[model samples]
Target: MMKWACHRPLALVLGMAGLAFGAPGAEATESGASLYLLGSGGPGTAVMPPLEGLYFDKMVWVYDGSAEANRRIPVNGNITLGLDTTIVADFTTLLAVPSTNFLGGTLAVGVTMPLGAPIIDAEGLLTGPAGGTTLTGSLHDSALTTGDPVVLTQLGWQADKLHIQLSTMTNVPIGHYRESGLANLSLHRWAVDGSLALSWHDPESGWDISAKAGYTANGDNRDSGYDSGDEIHIEGAIEKALSPKFSLGIQGYYQKQVSDDRGMLGPFRGEVVAVGATAATTVMMAGVPATFRGRIMEEIDTTNRLEGTSFWLDFTVPIHMNMPAG
Candidate 1:
């Protein structure tokens, strides 16, 4: 059996958590948000634990970006231009892997809950009561709120130096939401995502390469009468461990909308590409082994969305380990 880091299961759960909530974007969906957060999956995307156990993971994400002055963004039943946004959020995830196997693979289930606040500032042109009269105004909104929860299930298999996993995630739209609230945290709609991940790790050489691809299908928001289109995302990472406790890597992601969104000013489709650097290390926490990882990314290219930078910090710890009897 191949041995992964102590919290490989936790890393797997964290990747799925990115599929659960809406992330601030230029104008991907209603209010310039999307269900899938880009660049969420980095290294160790398909790695699973050799032993069955329970694990916990937490991630903090920060983003700052803005749309072009010519772009029109729909928010709170109004069209806005020169839109700028900032977001700070955290995701808490818990995962459980049983000793039992399904089809020669380990089966795991997990859940993630998110809490965040988004700040939005925009300038808009409004028509006055008088004909052909235009008024320019600015609006700013910010509030702390809770986001929708996500549930995940996956089956993983390891073959010598290679690992593969199949996973599915669902969004539960029961978080803080308001159709007219510019700073709301929830999308107020259901969504589902299916993904496949692959990893190649050489224990002797300390090299790891991983990739993940997923598709998201979104449902309509009845309150806003908006229907977001389907989307696809791909993420990849290449890492080399310099020492047992530390490693450095490069990661990137590509995201694009595959369908057209309804109830928008026009046929709104979003696309973006981002690349970044990542680092990871292992440490002991209260006598338990834990893993810490950080990443910073910048959007080099974008269309119909905001172009900005994002930072991520993640922590993973195994709560319990169930070793098989000899």
Candidate 2:
């Protein structure tokens, strides 16, 4: 028997969602897209799987957002006003956990590949050479393409009812991108993020609390001559197990840029706050245990970015498990 059967189902969902990135217009960074998805690390952030195995996770995300006419957004070496955008992306991730331990903790490695369709409708403006003349027009573009892949590594430690994890993720810019397209699915820049997560779970009381904080350092987009600044993100969740197989929770996140973007007309920092509800459950598929989770979030406040709502659906299953020899 696997050790996860005796533990809470939350352990099965850990580290999977946090590896997903790249949804344009859903959050904010350079060109109205970021390498770190805002609501990706909501619940079960610090827990590690009890059994060594290979796991597969699939996530479906949708977002619809818009910026007011008063704000300006830099995109494709041009500026846009009153940006309205919709994004739909799917992420497939694979996680591998070995039977070995490193530095007194469990080590895990994973990768996420994302495909996205982004639509943008906005008022466009282009300036001539040496700021000589200006052109204004309406722009609408849409594309279905692959986004950047993210690779991650994490170390997890457990102490009684508390769990902690340290993780690093890197974005590889081999996805589909066009320098002059408004509906590009990739950021076309290299970026790295480091995060720390903590979780307190009381099995007897069926209560779980988790929080994660991360920092992202972005590289310049050579195609657009844009240097995106660093960013900070914080996410938290609180949940109660209704039964051994089901749980419900509330989750929220805050994201803000810590520095200014270069090659833009003026200040181009972005910030947003969002809150939502999440639910998860465990089920059996083909005699193997599987987990399903869902979340919906609405942005309550935003600055220099789009304000919108997002929906997420995730499914995870262990493809192979290494049972301990008795």
Candidate 3:
């Protein structure tokens, strides 16, 4: 019997990291809503059911050094560390539908909470009024965001050797938008985002292929001086099954800045190239099957890609309450 009871929180952590990393790109508008929410939910990804809907997965995860950029500041020479950290938690519920066709689908609705902030640490840059030598200090109120509750809907289509999917999400600022906790940053507004994905399976060739794409738009920023812009990311992954219940996969994505304005804030722009791998397995508990999954992603700039890399891990186990005893 498998109990992924403790791994659910791991998925939330990874989702939060995505929210942080996706904020700085040249195309990221930094407009209305919170940028943190955008990162938690990747592009073109929806609530997908695992293992024929016997059970759905709920997950949470956290990792550092995922995507951090160090740059020189003009005034003091303090190195600005733009870091991304994320958290997400959601449940999957299977809908009622007759199984007449081998290729089937499911719908999942849940909330994604993302929180991110900027931490400025100074190096040997210039001098401040207090000292004639190098200055060191951290910026206050630099990190601002919310991990709002996003309503998600996903459609999955699977067959003998092929599967495809699409998903969409809308963020509702339900947490303490002005007060910060658990997630760090604070927010006071809402937003919306959408994504789509397609995957193929070939057991004969011992390989699996998938492609994904997505977009986001901020609604309203309560703090002012910042706006969220629309963004896009496309990725493909290949998988090789090691056993009936185990597999290893590698995925890569290209994220582009689609919007021009900085929303209400000044213009800051860049693009990203993401590469990563995943390991997954299936387990049975109480005569019911569940899935355990993990993933890590490394991101770099495409044009003048940054030097540092960001990484995170995700674990998921679906919970299906309505499935009849099999």
> By lDDT, who's the top model here?
1
Go through the candidates in order and give each one's C-alpha lDDT.
0.73, 0.72, 0.43
What lDDT tens digits, residue by residue, belong to model 2 across residues 1-326?
12232122322222211212112222245665666777777666787777788878888888887776655667767766667788887888788887537788888888888787888887755655532167688888888888778887878988998989898888888888867688876778888889898988777787888898999898888887778788898999998878878888998999888987777554457777899998887788888877788889998977767778888888878788787898
What tens-digit string does per-residue lDDT give for candidate 3 at 246-276?
Answer: 7777777775556643332234544667677
- How many clashes in candidate 1? 2
Two-way lDDT contest, 1 vs 2, winner: 1
Residue 132, candidate 1: C-alpha displacement in angstroms: 14
Each model's TM-score? 0.90, 0.90, 0.65
Which stretches in model 2 have alpha-carbon errors above 4 Å? 1-28, 127-132
* Candidate 1, lDDT over the whole model: 0.73
Backbone clash total for model 2 is 0
- In angstroms, the error of model 1 at 207 is 0.6
**Candidate 1: tens digits of C-alpha lDDT, residues 1-326:** 22255214254432222211122322566665666667766777888766688878888888888776666665544566777788888888888888537889988888888788788887754432321146568878888888788888888998998989898888888988866667766767898888998989777788889999999888888886678788898999998888878888999999888988776454578788899998888887777678888889998988777788888888888788786787
- Report lDDT (Cα) of residue 269, candidate 1: 80
Q: After superposition, how far is residue 128 of candidate 2 from its true place, in Å?
A: 3.6
